[model samples]
Target: MALKPLGFYQRLQQLTLPAQQAFMAALCERQLPNYALYAQTTGCGDTHALKAVLDLVWEQLSVRGASIDFARQAEKLVECEPPADDDSFGARRALDVVVSLFSLLDTLRGEAPEAVLDVSRTSRAGVRAFIELTEGEEDAQRLALLIRDHPLTDDENGFQDAVLDAVSQPLNKALLKDVRRLGKNDGVSNLGLSLE
Candidate 1:
């Protein structure tokens, strides 16, 4: 049976592939290995395992009618550690944003929870970042800086470089492919995730 396209589903399908990929890639880079980084983060506000927090965010928001405010959503994203306040700020900031993201995902998943995994770019950036950070290569960071310089152009080989570089990671294959798939199918909704 064919399912009708949901409104939000239509929007998700419409996002530009490169733009979405870049955003997802950046978001993925900021993730932590676990909550352990929290206490160790000290003033960086790394309290609580990051992955755990993200998990919590997911759990809390998978309810009905939940959604995030897109305007603040991007700014509210946790990219830096929280400032000192006797309590850990980084974890708090991360958690807060996750709460919003959770709502967003929940709203999106309301119609099709299963599709979430099949089409999620949420973890894309974190996975890539984890590899780069773990590898601890100067080139990785340099490449990131270069990306900043060359925004939205696949011609510079930067986007190609990103895919090639991240290809080594297990998660990157799906993430990159999904990004490309998303771009191509912009504005079109398929009942199944299949591109064709």
Candidate 2:
């Protein structure tokens, strides 16, 4: 069965705070290539800075009392945002990656109760945009069903399920490592974009 967005959000909410943070981080990790490709193609954003933020986020999740300057990190992320008027698919995907990381940071800061949900939505929206671009589907209703049933969408849901299952277990450095590997998906993004 296909996983609905609301159902996914509900499952995400059931995870503990650390688990939720890890989930968001894993999703962000999967999307990093989107920004990396955008930066490589257009030289518009800093891929290294975004990677640093995600690294710190993972450190906070895995290491106890790991003090992270999230406010400063958020400021750095703001600088990485793609121009709103770029209107390219690459820029849109890059923006989605940044937004997902920002939501993760907001969750870490206790500043947004729905930050996790926002990450979930943003990730799925990125996939949807990818489908729309490649498939050339113009009918709204048909595209909605097409997105719901797409193989990439299935991969996204399956990836999230795997991350949740790994995180729901006892939290530890090893588990976080495993989750990060899972998110890497052999360096492919949820939409199948890769740096290499």
lDDT of each: 0.36, 0.90
TM-score of 1: 0.26
Q: Would you give me the overall lDDT of model 2? A: 0.90
Per-residue lDDT tens digits for candidate 1, residues 1-196, read: 9987555334434444333333223232232322224435554533343344343333332333435443433243343334435444335434433433443334333433333222233333333433444445577667676444432222212433343334324333355555334322332211111212
lDDT of 1: 0.36
In TM-score terms, candidate 2 sits at: 0.93
Candidate 1: RMSD to truth: 14.5
TM-score of each: 0.26, 0.93
